[model samples]
Target: MGVIRLPSQSRLLCFAFHIIFILFQQTTAERELKFVVVVFRHGDRTPVVNFPTDLHKESEWPQGFGQLTKTGMQQLYELGQYMRKRYSNFLNSTYKRQEFYIQSTDYDRTIMSAQSCLSGLFPPTSSQTWNPELPWQPIPVHIVTKSSDRRLHFPLHDCPRFDELQNETQTSSEFQNRIQPYKDFLQTMAVNTGLELNNLRTLDNFQLWNTYDTLYCEGIHNYTLPVWATKDVMDKMEKLAELSLLSLFGLYETEEKSRLQGGVLMNTILKSIKQAVNSSRERKMEVYSAHDTTIGALQIALNIFNGKLPPYAACQFFELYQESSGRYSIEMHYRNDTSKDPYLLTLPGCTSSCPLEKFAELVSPMIAENWSKECGKKDKKKDIFIGFDVAVGLLFIFDLVLLYLLYHYGRCRRRNNYQDL
Candidate 1:
């Protein structure tokens, strides 16, 4: 037993290593991601709708029209893997039903994309698999039939008020200003492409979007476009398509329009975030596999859009955290480009890590107290009821006036009679 002591330099080295280890442990033990809500457009797929002149008809696609392509599946698979790496600390490494959830629009492409994405996100391992040969596991993707769906899908249909809003938007000074410069080009496109266009103003949002999508899909698949689809025409169509997107709930009373459309989804997302914070083990993450419109609507609702269509598989992530100060906050990120890390998105009125309550307050105007009422689905009934009440009030006032006139006439007659007497 020798009284051996380490050299002074060695003692200092040991002390430094101990301190570094403690700091690393503390950093891990202290910081935690409490909740996550990730919403993403479905991966690349066949165009949802196409023009009559298009060479790629509905039958030309693998599953006919609007089906997910193999390329689309791969894209979502890659996206899921990216999510796994990005949230390795927050989410469990293994597939755990209690830790995660997923949903998608009620479309073949979206539903399949959800499955493909989940395959990459939670590859089956050990007892989680039913068959050793298959690396996939069945994960439920919640969705309502298109007819009943309201919250997850964007540019919701059957909302006549939203349609009226669009009518006004197309007539706005800003809308005219943006589209005025493209008047000649739009006419040229209609003439050349045989796309029936009565006038520049008649280029409705869906029509513009449809043209752009056809050209875009054709270009990507290396299909030969007609001579009419020149670069200039395509460029203008792209601009018009962008404008069409803005026309959707972004122009004129943007907040109120959002409350009736994207805000429904936002509320659902926030609800999940709040729930996750309250119970950590119950749910760790929520994923929505939808369309480009879904992402666009959400971006505008969050007031963070960058003025372009979100590309295929684009995603918006809502990450929740509990700070050491005992307060909860939200962090948002957009992942449109796979080459780089997702960019952090800050609410225009708040910091990147906005407090949860503050985020709710700032976004409250966009969330509808009653979605159907906001969409004016019951406007006719409401109008009739109001009209009836107003009519009743007017009748009562008219009766009062008639009675007063009668009383005045009787008083004058009685006074005259007395005077004559």
Candidate 2:
């Protein structure tokens, strides 16, 4: 070592070589991010449905109810630009047909959000530019009509079993206990909002939330809220809303509900992940623009939901990676708050970087073999009746056979007696 120290140039070269070797090892050990699935709520919008008495009526909103506002457009646009920067190391500088996909819930707010987001992510460049003045190019946002879209939407309608489950949930001890304290407050809501809650359905926690949302949005947008609408009331409404959503998706028989609703989406996602891996597909990303319920439902299905509403433009990511050992792994991240990077979430039974095979196996139970069938397209009552009828028919056939055998024995005994006489 003392002899080597005599040559400064040689020592410097040796140090650089050691540093390069370490860097090379680290690079080779790093896993490669192969694909990603990004799902997000639509940005802020006019209330979905508002009370009749509210000052910010349907006419007050530019594109009517449930439409995206300028603020919403800006939110998605910024998010798109952020994504472009975030994935610059992975994604190409310009848009490619097979690199990514965008889908929405056939709603103006969500569809527009996707378009606005794409504008920022893939601004037209070089040959891609049609007009010199416009930086945007068309990106197709796919959708299935709402009624047929249980996979992306939530509180999935037309599911009789889910409806039955919800009814059961309301009667659950947990629901009764949680709602007992809020009964008076909700009655006050019924009075102040001028909405008549005559039945159990009308007395829903979700309804109270909508009423609060309307007034709150109005107040924020310069329209005066009702004098009765106070911060305390809003907070209470928000909690009730969260509870309503929870009660719907869980709080009783969580797994069954997940199989009926959230499982559908999760199954689709897992399929895409597997296909990308096995078929060596070029699909690098799949971006889904959906409602808050969609995000919540998916989280619930994965058993990773944090028991709160996912805020506006809240996003969840499922990323796939191939390790140096040639094995694949899945990782999940959630970005609900703007102030911080996405939090890495671990699957209940598996590590955050769970193997692809293990991830699929762990989640297989949640995936419904038939979503519609599980949701009660096949009648349970009919099946019971059919079984009952079959049992009765079998019993009748056995009795008939017994009666015939007894008659034959009697006839044989009479013939023997006559012959003896």
Candidate 3:
């Protein structure tokens, strides 16, 4: 065969193309995405509870209090679609149980949110379609009772140490100073909303967040705000609500508080990352359908919180990548605003693509080795209380038996006397 000669320009073009191809391959090999863990808040919903004096009632909502609204389902469905687009290349078109897992808090809103998200993420493929008319497939969303779900639920009510720390945080000079500006506003809110100022300030369950959240939800749905819930008042309420949330996870001894709250979820995520790195057939992604507090608690634990309530359908991503050097790195991203790209979050002491070891080390202090132990819970006391109750019951039984025997003996003696007479 005769060798064909090319012009100088043509030779140069070929050389450039060859180099580009080689570089693309090298780049692809250098950064391979291995696994992803996404934690997202439930979407918009009716207010959890109506204020005592508010015109809006729970009955007005299509679903009663705290259940997911149609709008909320749409928000999550859109979020799931976004996830599908974002991970199209990474995830299979068909739902594969071994390749993906999803869990949600055991609330009507969260469970429904997960289902909605899944419907968007994995519409039934032709082969998997059971109902041709309906474009959805059933994917189990694992859940535990809210009381027992320590991983996803935050501000754990059972953690006495957490409660103590929160109380201490409330009393700190910093907290007092922060709330000083909101005192008048809080009092005004108390008068208008029929909520006690003291409880609104101190109780996590009834914090100012509830009021702000109720108003926020109403405003979104175009309900006319009461005269007292003016623009300025709403703004102040938001600030106070944010402050209240921060106080729960931060404001004082942030690291210690996180260990008992958000750290539990962080621990689970870290374990999953480790498993993905070590296992051969690892799941591609794990989804957690939770609440705003869940995201807030996690970000606080990681020390990357943005100091605002996570908006409805907001999501946080933990992505694990293997570098060319045979080491894994983690990248965190927060997607709160739909208009903007997700914010890149760096571990305080490490770079955005933090090394696995470095990431683990930085987060270790926040991760509790034993949640109950760290929460200052003592099983011995429970055992002792149980023992005392058992002992008291046994003594009562013994007394009853003695009384019955005495009555029987006295009745027999009387009968014998009557017979002898």
Candidate 4:
């Protein structure tokens, strides 16, 4: 070493290099993440409804209301194949029974759709055969029953706040503007079906809305709809249904419906991701098969409604990756068109893929408060409805009182007339 101490500049340069090296190493560690979560609508099925005058009704379909059609099966199978191809590298060479998990709403269509997906995703290969004679082994698809249903299931309860919101929305200037063009469409439907639009307006508050939902559900269940329902008509109906879902849960002022429904699903997914991250599990795909309403509500809650309505078999995906700098990024993908690559979603002040934590934080307010607690209370209330039967008993007493009053009034009038005579 030179008798002169190492220059201060050289020591400073060394310190700076060390810091840069540490940052580089940290960055390198973050970029190696691979995790994915997906929530998807069930494949096509029979319509939700069939108007009284419509030629195509529930009888047209072999499986009654809300059943999956053969076409739906084909659609899901194709989707499964697509997933297999897309994630071949991420998944095992052969489908590992334990590597992936699937859950669906406890409906026949959704259950079948999940099964169909599994069929296409992990077709029985020659190598997987424990016995040549029996090539297939049952892959479990978990479902929450209607009685014990959770996030991905049927019979979503009515939220009074959401109901109030819907009423407000019906009267809103925006809704009025949106429905103006559809008025002509409604009139045409009314004319063809012999349903008086004025009668509908007076008698049924949501006549048109109900009509569309019925058609939409019936279509998904494999029933043929009326000829009047062209692609454009069905498209419009889908939009209306989506609006209904948004009104149910996504509306800001109403009871936080999104939190109860989609918000719960999001929380579950996040919890799963966190678990995976902590456990360092290489397997990172989470799949949920649910109703169109689920997807619609989630999309609305996220404020990511693409103009086109999400059809049966629609899928929303969230991919999480850690960057080299130890930062996590999230990417949102939507598969509205099976043929095309999923469209990327962009969040304000963030890329389509933002940090997982940030994504949760953004949606936290929308999550319904005490959701699990409320759900528990609901179960208890449902039991009371059965045990007490107060609603039914009250109706019975009211009917009796009305009949008594009517009879007494008639007798009094007759006596008065007799006295006058």
User: Which residue runs does candidate 1 get wrong by more than 4 Å?
Assistant: 1-29, 198-202, 279-281, 379-421
Q: Indicate the residue-level lDDT of 46 in model 2.
A: 85
Give per-residue lDDT, candidate 1, residue 122: 90
Clashes of each: 0, 0, 0, 25
Root-mean-square deviation per candidate:
5.7, 6.2, 7.4, 11.4
Ranking by lDDT: 3, 2, 1, 4
Better of 3 and 4 by lDDT: 3
- Give the number of the best model, judged by lDDT: 3
Q: Give the alpha-carbon lDDT of every model.
A: 0.83, 0.84, 0.90, 0.71
| Top candidate, metric TM-score | 3
Instruction: Tell me which of candidates 1 and 3 scores higher on lDDT.
Output: 3
lDDT of 3 by residue, 1-421 (tens): 9999999999999999999999989978779889999999999898988888787988887777888888989999999999999889889988999899999989999999999999999999879999999999999999999878888987787888988888898889979899887777778888899888787766356557887888888899888779888889989888888887788898899999999999989999999999999988859999999988899899988989989999999999999999988899999999998888889999899999999999999999999889898888879889899999999999999999999999999999999999999
The clash number for model 3 is 0
lDDT tens digits, residue span 1-421, model 2: 3543448888799999999999888866687988889899988888878875665668877888888888888888888887888788777788998888888998999999899889888999999999999899998999989877866988788889988988788888988888888778777777777776543233354666677667766776778788788889888877877777777777788899999888889999998998889896678899999988899889988999998888878889999999878899999999898778889999999999999999999999889898778887867788899999999999999999999999999999999999999
Candidate 2: misplaced stretches above 4 Å? Answer: 1-29, 198-205, 379-421
lDDT score of residue 295 within candidate 1: 87
Worst 10 residues of 4 by lDDT: 199-208
| Model 2 score (lDDT) | 0.84
Query: What TM-scores do the predictions have?
Result: 0.83, 0.83, 0.86, 0.71
